[model samples]
Target chain A: MENTTSNQTAQNDLQVLRTSSLTGALERELEHLILTGELKPGERLNEIQLSSRFGTSRGPLREATRSLQAKGLVDAIRNRGVFVRSISPKEALEIYDIRAALFGLAGRLLTDMVTDAMLARLNEFLDEMDEIAQQRDFDRYYPVNLQFHDFLIRSTNSSMLAQEYKSLVNRLHLCRARGLVQAGGLAVSNHEHREMVDALASGNRERAQEAFFRHVERSKQRFTTTLEK
Target chain B: MENTTSNQTAQNDLQVLRTSSLTGALERELEHLILTGELKPGERLNEIQLSSRFGTSRGPLREATRSLQAKGLVDAIRNRGVFVRSISPKEALEIYDIRAALFGLAGRLLTDMVTDAMLARLNEFLDEMDEIAQQRDFDRYYPVNLQFHDFLIRSTNSSMLAQEYKSLVNRLHLCRARGLVQAGGLAVSNHEHREMVDALASGNRERAQEAFFRHVERSKQRFTTTLEK
Candidate 1:
């Protein structure tokens, strides 16, 4: 009886661990759906549908929705349920301004903190990005583009800043997905990334900061110009 | 029979609405508890205890916990339950750096956007803060101090920046409660607020930004110093 009870307790513990990991995975999938625009702006997310889609229970589904709501990716109504958040042009401009500040800070910190190995890694990433841009393989380039930003944030060794930056990037990604597709934007973004990497390699904090700002500003211009048209 | 059915429907709807609002309120309360350090760093939050204290159901309680986790104020451990996040000194420094970047952007935007009426309202807040400072009432000054920051954010008319700033403020507040209890630090902070308000009134963006940076820098210094001692 004692052995059987122990086995049952261990099984229950494993179930709890499995549930926690499942919740994390569910959160990521929902975030990706919003970021990729599968769930468009102001569209209500049906819990029953999402639950079946993820093969999760209502408890975890509701938890994931709450997480997204806090990230500003989703908004919950009292009776209606959660919906993807929509951004206005004005709010988009504000987002860019915030992005400029955040990325600029990251650049400055990256310059200060970049080791020889870090620079080499960045250079390696940039080389791959250049190849992707040359081939116009945006499908491959898009993920690399995200990795470059992620690299800067990670190199700062600041978890708090990284967390805040991740939230901003998620929102930006969602907004960017709604706009008209710009083929040239990727190449332009690559050029800016090269400039940023060069500034960091040279340890020029001011130049790095400026390059980072310009990068975000150019992307913002593209977004706004498209939005206007 | 019709009346009874309608009454039941109304009750159900009301329950849903009440739960939603209760979840929000619980989130705010839990946030305050974390920010004020009434809930100590790394302390576990029991679901049953929290539900009873907030006078809510487990559903709303779990929902509120999820929200707090998203804000980076809490962390969940499956069956073990949620715990308030502990910010290390290093994490605190990174937060201040981010704040400098964010508030500097806000200050620059405020200079470009500040109207005469907005300046007047800012001065009114300053005056009230000054009166409270003179009385050496830290408790009364705290809320006013927060209002001043909130006012700047709102004045910028950037919902995105405002949202990001709110998150930064929440994280910063988590690290500040203990450090802020020092008399000298509190006085210096009050003085800094006065200087920031003056800079804003003069429409000196550079000065305003500098004042804002110094304000955050001073707080960071105090917190680090207190931690060391």
Candidate 2:
């Protein structure tokens, strides 16, 4: 009887771990959905529908909604339900301002911590970006550009900074579907990326900071210009 | 029958709004608990227990947990339950680095956006801080110091920056319990606050930025010294 109870306890622990991992996976999926604009802003999330769609039970679905709510991606109403958060123009500008500060810090830290190996990896990524830019492959280039920024942020080796940066970038991604359609911005973006990488390679902290700021400012300009039309 | 059906719909909508507001309040409470260290790191947050403590039901309690998880305050495992997040010395340092960058931005923006009324209000707050410092009332001065930084950030009128700043401050509060202990740092802190406010009042961006950086460095020094001992 003692042996059986011990085995049962071990089995129960494994089951708990599995469920937690499953919940985490579900949360990530929902995060992607919101960040990628699969679920548009202000769209209501029906738990029952989502559970059926994901082939899960309501338990995980509810948990995922809670996760998203914490991330500022969704708003939970008392009895009603959760809905995707809508970003206003004012909110967008505010987000960009904070992003600029974060990227500025990342650039400075990146310069301070640069290694030849890291530069080479950055160059490899930039070359891929160059090819995509030449082909005007906005779809493919967008994700690559994001990866480059992510790489630099992670390279800084500051997890807190990276975590906050990730949230800002995710929010920006949600707004990208509406903003990245600007004319002639793609080439400028690629050029900015090149300049930024050069600044990092040279270990010029001031220039690196400027380059990153300029890149974000240019994106903001593009966004505003699109909104104007 | 139609009247009854419409009434039911109205009731459901009301319930949703109520749930959202309740969840919001719950999030704030949980955040306070985590930041104030009332909830110890790695402590289990059982839903049933939390619900009873907060006088809420399981639904809102779970929702609050999700929000905290997103903020990196708590980790929820499947059948096991949620636990408060734990940080090490390395993580604490990383968080301080991020705070430096963020508060640096706030400083620059505060200089650029300073208004006459804001300066007056800041001066008023500074006088109060001076009085508290003279009295060696760290308890009163502690919150005033936070408000000085908070006021500066809010005056920038950048909600997103304020939100990110609040998060970093919350994390710092959790890590070291800064300003909670009765130390002789209040005098230096008051002097720094005066310098920061004066720099802002003068609309000298570079000076303000330097002062802000110095202020943050001083705080970090205090925290590190305390942690070392």
Misplaced by over 4 Å in model 1 are A1-16, A19-21, A127-137, A180-182, A185-187, A201-207, B1-20, B120-144, B185-211
Mark the regions of model 2 whose C-alpha exceeds 4 Å error after superposition.
A1-19, A127-137, A181-183, A198-207, B1-22, B55-57, B176-184, B201-210
iRMSD (Å), candidate 1: 2.5
Best candidate according to lDDT: 1
Candidate 2 global CA lDDT score = 0.78
The prediction achieving the highest TM-score against the true structure is 2
Can you list each candidate's DockQ?
Answer: 0.50, 0.50
* Candidate 2 A-chain TM-score: 0.81
Shift of residue A72 alpha carbon in model 1, Å: 1.8
The global C-alpha lDDT for each of the candidates, from Candidate 1 onward, is 0.79, 0.78
Could you give the interface RMSD of each candidate, to one decimal?
2.5, 2.3
